[model samples]
Target chain A: MAETRQWRLASRPTGEPTRENFDLVTVDRPEPGPGEVLVKTLYQSVDPYMRGRMRDEESYAEPWDVGDPMQAGIVGEVVQSEADDFDEGDVVTGNLLWAEHAVADADELRPVNPELGPVSTALGVLGMPGITGYFGMLDVADPSPGETVVVSAAAGAVGSVAGQIARLSGARVVGTAGSEEKIDWLTDELGFDAAINYKETDDLEAAVAEACPDGVDAYFDNVGGPITDAVWPLLNVDARVAVCGQISLYNETEVPTGPRKLSKLIESRARVEGFLVGDYQSRWGEALESLSEFIQQDDLHYRENVVDGFENAPDAFLGLFEGENIGKQLVKVAERGE
Target chain B: MAETRQWRLASRPTGEPTRENFDLVTVDRPEPGPGEVLVKTLYQSVDPYMRGRMRDEESYAEPWDVGDPMQAGIVGEVVQSEADDFDEGDVVTGNLLWAEHAVADADELRPVNPELGPVSTALGVLGMPGITGYFGMLDVADPSPGETVVVSAAAGAVGSVAGQIARLSGARVVGTAGSEEKIDWLTDELGFDAAINYKETDDLEAAVAEACPDGVDAYFDNVGGPITDAVWPLLNVDARVAVCGQISLYNETEVPTGPRKLSKLIESRARVEGFLVGDYQSRWGEALESLSEFIQQDDLHYRENVVDGFENAPDAFLGLFEGENIGKQLVKVAERGE
Candidate 1:
């Protein structure tokens, strides 16, 4: 490859991120060194968490430096390799550049099989979001049989898988989302017992209360803020909440305030915990196995909102906050043999 | 017994409770019925949680009826018995009335020994607060050696013991209190690494950060609201917070609002759990055994702010919110053998 088109961080965002904060640039594609593979990007994952990386301040993940090409969970095919770990035709997925072609260490590239599922799925249900939903629901939330589990941002990548996993645990699943389409996708297609269109609902607490008559036993919180506040009063005794993501607060310039629910937690003897998929790195194979099984058995349904072309990648990332995607949001950078 | 002096619920208070909410009355001593025993009150425990009972609303515990005498965890003597289980003169502690004399089901009373420590301790260290600290600190928070543990309301009955327990686990204990005397007791007597008089501290978060330089690993929270708001930002990765009580908000007429820290939990991957001592009913014996050993070995010290007369029971209970009591607040209805 002569040139690699990439989206680089132009500046740190103040409030909600904009296109001006990113710059599209073309750089000469470097040759693969020893123990490295050159890959042509097939699909690129865009997630809400990437917003945190755009800030200059320190957070859980390191800030993406200004003028650096942004990195994402990109699935690509190896076009050139100098390592025994990969062949020229091998399909791989890893944390790589948001570009048409990039060089990565062979060890960083995880091989993906096109025989098992669609190649693009390695960026969504078969990858980070899937494993995140897997561990967070089963290990963190730990919902039991017949218990009511409520999930926020239900049609999103992590939340969608989390709700499905809760159902597999014999628990009643209720989901909250922004659109009727997402709500339908959750309840009608994904097997959630109830789905509340939070954007349309005037009284969120009442909607949640009606959906979870028995009170929420477990909560998979993907979008925090008001959604979590609504879930507070309805928590059953010993309720467990897994804080997966807080996309609602991610774009906010000022810290938001609300009715503090520590007292309510005490009254209910409930628990709220936060987690990141990266923390469960050691046990990912276990999660991937279960997620793959669920997908192969048709027990887990997957969806994606893919934006076409490398030029539209930044918009694909920004669309997360606007509730523009139904499931995992991704960008298609190139053809299979580009 | 000729007369039993008692405090009955006169009216429910809207905000902070007042003495006018209670009515002191003299009644004829009650006699034991079948399967019951007549108890003459000795040490009467007054806790912040009792404030919730005074409200005529649906909560975790049943609301105290307006016409009935306010009940509490009372240590008393069995004066007369119709039940074979409790011998006359046996020192017992149970959920009993504010009156000096009342009938209790034999099953309600738990036996306490004067030989192990002062029978008054059954109202403080060897009782509910002790078990609350035991389970909240050890079981829920689960602080490890070399970790920093912060306990709010750290001079109170539960918080003091919880901080001590964390210290016993080899964690550096940071305590927050309201009085200089209580601060002295926590740091000098109880071996707390640092104590902040939250009332005098201009910047609570800064003070907490200074006290817990390594960041908070475990937090035993008895006082919630702003004190908790300060601790949220200082949480280390995988921190455990035991929400034992929200004494600060117990009297709030409206739900108090503050910076929502749910997003911070996600960033730190921390866990906050609430618990009542009653939830560990099956494990009371284990807690008691550990508590007694801590006291017997002189590893633990206890303090009680004793109100000398039955007339002051309501005052003692009200003093909790004002930070009047240094340790366990109790009303001494009569002499031990009265």
Candidate 2:
């Protein structure tokens, strides 16, 4: 019998998620059923949206029930397979969890080949987050050549990939980040046209105007708050806004006050929209293929903030709110057996 | 020489407009130029947008210069014509002012025949405000047959007409107004599916949900603020928002805050857009013709709040902010000569 640990939802959070909200319990791993594979967990992703799922409230995704195991994107190696597709020693990735081992139907698990890049990349750039950035940026915003595209949280996993893909598509890309170092990475390393350090800037609207002189043609919004309020007025006529996340406002008990200038969107004749990545599931392959080509061409760059040990998973997840993690947040629970 | 009395901009107000913001001055009427006609002003229109014009700040239309005559849509008779398009005793309407008499270029005015409908209809359902509602609701939002459409200020000029047109196009029409009386008028008289009195409702979101059982498919937004915040979450997938005005926040010095949940827009895949009537100038004839046909078929209804004097124009204009006017605000400054 194999050993496994499961992180279960202990309690619903009121504001910021706490350690008390989750519990780790070790148990004997179950044998795989027919047409299923038992995966030995190698890496688990810690995402901001996991905070939303921990709450007993309605969201774009189903909320985690109290006393149920907390779920997230995970990469693992197939140890035992009763499935025709997945074989022993095959690496796989899926929406598994913070578990040492998990059993899922073969159809739900995607085989991960190291030849595609690093195995952890399956849970980061070449996975759901990468596909989200690629498809949402291209399909929702639909930027034209030379059009200015501004993204928020630019150094984060989704925004970084989104900006690079936008640049590859011939857009003039700008971004906003929480720290100066992230700003440097966005502008100097990631090839963003301009990167605004939102923490240092007193006036976000002025910074946006300076970066996008002709006005932003497309806005890939990840952090919706004062930053979005500032960008709303500066959008050109017919500009498209893709609302992927509102990380900054997620923890706030009250909505922030500013210009209430939603009417300005009418004046600019701009379209503000929201989207979920799951809606594009059928077309995800196109995103993966394009993102892979970009990565191979040296056109896209990604950073992984890999935390060691299952106990430190909470730290990595909490680091997202403080902007401590430079890229995708992940936890390596155990070494993979080749 | 003919006697003429003009209402001019006396001063710009800090917040709410006052009687002191306007000056009624009597001036000696001048002769018409080569292509001009001497018009004896009869019916002068007062609209919410005119309040914006009184300020010395820029808006969609240029601000009224300090001490200059206040301009608005006026119905008059051509007392004298120096151009072939107009003759003596012809009824005309154009951007005139709260004056007993004036001189205008023949090219700037449109001839209105009483055979079409009451001349007051021009300012209500057949003029700028009407055509504004027409083009905005039809061309911009494009509410299809059997779709659910909601309009704010349902008993007011633009909104009242917009709802009927939406109904004529086979939409389930819901509306919001300031009072129960107005709400009754919208639902009982105008044939709207439902109406919500925003002032009486504590939970606007719940009220809107009850009124619009199915999510809102199209929104003709004349009032922006809490009403907009309520409507945001109820928007269906592929929902269209035609931002006509933000009457609720127009007088506000700051932006109102609720829940900054714009990210929800992405989850619903809705589009919130802003627009100006002038931007659709090329489609004016089509809208005007269709609106005229609707009125001719008795498929549309409109109301007008006619203030008696040119001297009272400032009061009538300021009343818009207080939600005092029932429908189109117009000033019958002079008796018709025809």
The model with the greatest lDDT is: 1
lDDT of 2: 0.85
Candidate 2, A1-338: lDDT as tens digits: 66788988888877777788778898889789999999988899998778778766676778989988888899999999999998899999999877888999999999899777889988889998888788879988888899999999888989998888889889999999999889889987899999999999999999999999999999999888889888887888889998888888667655554457566676678877778888888987888888889888888999998999988887788788888877788899878784
- Model 1 misplaced stretches (Cα beyond 4 Å): none
Q: Which runs of model 2 end up more than 4 angstroms from their true locations?
A: A255-258, B144-146, B335-338
- Candidate 2, B1-338: lDDT as tens digits: 66688988888876777888778898998689899999998898888777667666665678888888878889998998999999998899998877888899998898999788888877888888888888888877789998999999888899998898899889999999998889888988889999999999999999999988888999999988888889878888878888888888666554555556476676677777788877876786787798888777778877889999877887888888888888788888777774
Per-residue lDDT tens digits for candidate 1, residues B83-123, read 98998999999999888888999999999887887888888
Please write out the lDDT profile of model 1 over residues A126-184, one tens digit for every residue: 89998889899999999999999999998999889999999999999999999989988
Supply DockQ values for each candidate.
0.86, 0.60
**What is the lDDT of every predicted structure here?**
0.91, 0.85
TM-score of each: 0.98, 0.94
A70 Cα displacement, candidate 1 (Å): 1.2
Q: What is the DockQ of candidate 2?
A: 0.60
